[model samples]
Target: MTQPSDYREHLMAAALFIAGRRWPVFPLRPGGKRPALHGEASCPRTGPCADGHRKWEERATTDPDRVRRAWSAGAFNIGLATGPAGLLVIDLDVPKDNTDAPDGAANFRALCERHGQPVPTTRTVRTAGGGTHLYFTAPASCRLHNTAGKLAPLVDTRAWGGYVVAAGSVIGGLPYETVGPALVHPLPGWLQFLLIPPHPVVRARAAAALRNAPAYARAALCNEEENVRNAPVGCRNATLLRAARALGRLVASGDLSRSAVETALRRAGQTAGLRDYECRSTITSALNWSIAHNSGRGAA
Candidate 1:
């Protein structure tokens, strides 16, 4: 007959595995996401807490002995403190309460396509709740904070002040498991741009150029902007690509300035709820490709 699950042993091994990676690990309440660390009010102010109450972030440790001792206390789930671990984790969550909200992974994929980029391949965990967590190394000297709905709908991030449930955690009879490479990749520059504040120098200059452009180029830009703004959810990226390609030909033919065309498409993409990085990447790429392949130079 098959042996029953050994809760403590299993959890201890899990905690050890993560700790071995040098990531500081803490505990979550078994079967839930809440931190299992002692609260300030309940602090006995003894042992490690002799001076004062130590929150989870302070108590998180990469030591195997501490992990084993902590796991011996109960069937605790692993919580990787991202900041201490030097990680930035992207949480692609499922729709809440069975609502009809868009799926996080799909939205993220669309966001990638809109920017002419492929999804970054990195360390990944499939959560028990049927979502995914992608892990990336945080940039040195940058203290990032958690962001909600910043990248896309259902796409959240955890860094300095947050933690992620690690593989080997369980909830509702499902285990969080590794589904990708063992190595965590450095965060991509494009993604970093999306997370940070944008500089307005290019956009300001692009607008000025558009004001002085010939009427035909201006009219063409107006038509393309409308197309992007009115594009439905599934068609937005394709529409933006097409418009960029068409305008790129104009730039090649000396009918419009590159920056002017780019500025118009960028605003139109953002109006359709695309992220800033996505708009810039897509427009720039399409323009480059179209300009290079322009056969009907000055035909218009």
Candidate 2:
């Protein structure tokens, strides 16, 4: 095994190599997940701009020079910014202390089977802690959020607003290794559906009663509308689609008119900063899917 001191040069070389590939990279403290910085203050106390021990996500950079400087001082782990680099990582965590935990890989396979999709073989990285990171390209229209134990026990996702330590990074004298192809593949569509599922359409009561439905139903609709209206860039289409689908359920139950749903979705998408054409296309597609799947039924 290479001593920690001996790995500095190799780490710097790897950092430069990753940056050369246009993947934003940052430094993590030696053998730790925290950002590696000289004197940067942590966030909340000093805000994210102080540069003192700042979050790796905020400091991740694609500039080769910046990456070189980050690894020049000493040994550091490389962090990959997922969303900015258009990457998504599925982290299969194996419990270090528990011996009876279910195998994450097996669980992942079963999940794919349940979804009727093949497991994606992408860029796989073996983590220091005996876990795995499966890297894939982010879908063009969907921004997956990080969630622990969402897909299966100990299965996590790292995408928008998240980061993953690069394969060459070392922790506790153990290095992350590439166990699969070097290239990151695009996310499979069926897996994408499982990850970012459309909102469920609940059964509606009488159309006249729906107009005077309980406060909860109205609140749910308002929340969906707000989600569309406040969606950030890179996520507007998905948010708009969700909102439109919610409205479509209402339309299916005859609680809302199709034209009303379309107009509302268009307005909300526009408010969320989508272009006219994008809003129109997304709303049209979402309404079509919702109406087709939800026709003649209030429950989904």
Top candidate when judged by lDDT against the true structure: 1
Estimate, for each residue in 51-73, the C-alpha lDDT of model 1 and write its tens digit.
99888888899999899889999
Off by over 4 Å in 1: 1-4, 197-300
lDDT of 2 by residue, 28-49 (tens): 8877877665344324435445
- Global CA lDDT computed for model 1: 0.86
Count of backbone collisions within predicted model 2:
4
Model 2, position 33, has a per-residue lDDT of 79
User: Which one wins on TM-score?
Assistant: 1
Could you tell me every candidate's TM-score relative to the true structure?
A: 0.68, 0.64
Q: Which pairs of residues clash in candidate 2, taking residues 3 or more apart in a chain or in different chains? A: 40-52, 40-53, 41-52, 203-298
